[model samples]
Target: MSARFAFNHATAKFWDQREAVEACARAGAGIGLWREPVQEMGVAATAKLVRDAGVAVTSLCRAGFFTDPTPAALEDNRRAIDEAAAVGAPVLVLVSGGIPDGGTIDSARDGVRQALAELAPYARERGVTLAIEPLHPMFASDRCVVTTLNEALDLAAPFAPEAVGVVVDTYHVWWDPQVWQGIARAGREGRIASFQFADWVTPLPAGVLTGRGQLGDGCVDFKRYLAEVDATGFTGPIEVELFNDALWARPGAEVFAETKAAFERVTA
Candidate 1:
């Protein structure tokens, strides 16, 4: 399956931004970036670095966390859109914020709806797609209210494709019984803004943030996912965004090499 593979820098969260870009450039691979490092390095400077290296910034790590819809949060997200445009990445992945204090999960989801309604136009103006990522259900209460591709698509359906979309991350939605159907529906709706790969493993670490297993290290049926997404005629970059602490503890270069190999092995 001729899928275009990209490495998400969160796999080595401590890696220097320049080193990650250079590694991706050397491997002829695309990269997914995070906001903290981009901000620390200066958005324009990082943009120049990626441009100089001739590497594709597949998508920016995140922008939306608007469970409260505070003016400050919206402003921050707007800044993220500009940064994404500056870096030449078409999509700004959104981790829909968790439940707000004194609020239910449903209320948090409603907040996401309001936040999207407010930000979609801004993103469209900047030529960036706000890609809502439905994190694993385990994180539903504290990390992301959007917990499945179906929910994400429903959230995105109200917007134009270029203005808003959804992310299909294997680690997050692999356990959903209707995942394949969700992928199909996402394709039919033209909202698959991001396709990410990460295996789900047991003994989720404290906070369950960096517990993603390496590709083929868990039960994800990557080949089936690839084939299903392919059937939708959605030809886009496939990114591996592992958040394993073990991988992060290793050298970024070594981790990058191992990740690329794992991606190739399972996707092949």
Candidate 2:
């Protein structure tokens, strides 16, 4: 079976948000937009534009980061769910926020649990699924505290199918020893909300967060991932979400073309 591809809007940050979406539509690619870009375009307007362009809003880039577990944060996530619903996006990717001041990773995980409990029902009400994305363990200090697909699935276990799920991103999780098992569990539990691809590279870049590689530029067995997820009957859009400075420096159209080519090649 062939894999369908989606482009995360950040991959084309050089272009205006709406223009990026339009470009993806023109390229016959699905779109995964970040919240800020969507806000800049106005949720309703962006939604309408994407719909008019005949493009699929595969997923909203993010909504979680509710580590504070405050009422304000929960409200913000609720609003995010509404925005995703407006854009006809079924999945709202969630990055469980980093460790709070003087807090342990375990404590941060607890905060994520509480945040999910509060927001899952709201997301379900709005017909949006919250997809918990586990960032790389290297980011366990300052990015998402959820650092593995297994942990993410365990976190989403309590929620019903439409309320909570997990996002599997290759850049963040490809190095995990238990990734295969996690993917299988995500499938068995029906928690595979989104599947993102970005190649992994080494050399300890200063800003490790933004140095993702193009699909074929690094060492990732994407075919293995595709086979694992496809075995779960997950035929959802495979989103390319690279954040490499090199790719970003290029023109949006060039980046889009190269990413699409890479997707085709890797999944071939």
The lDDT leader among the candidates is 1
Model 1: lDDT equals: 0.91
Clashes of each: 0, 0
Model 2 stretches astray by more than 4 angstroms: 1-3
- CA RMSD for every model? 1.2, 1.2
Model 1 RMSD to the real structure?
1.2
Tens digit of per-residue lDDT, candidate 1, span 83-134: 9999999999999888889999888988999999999999999999999999
* Per-residue lDDT of model 2, residues 154-256, tens digit only: 8998999789999999988999999999999999999999999999877756777778888887888999999999999999999999887877888888888
Candidate 1 TM-score versus the reference? 0.97
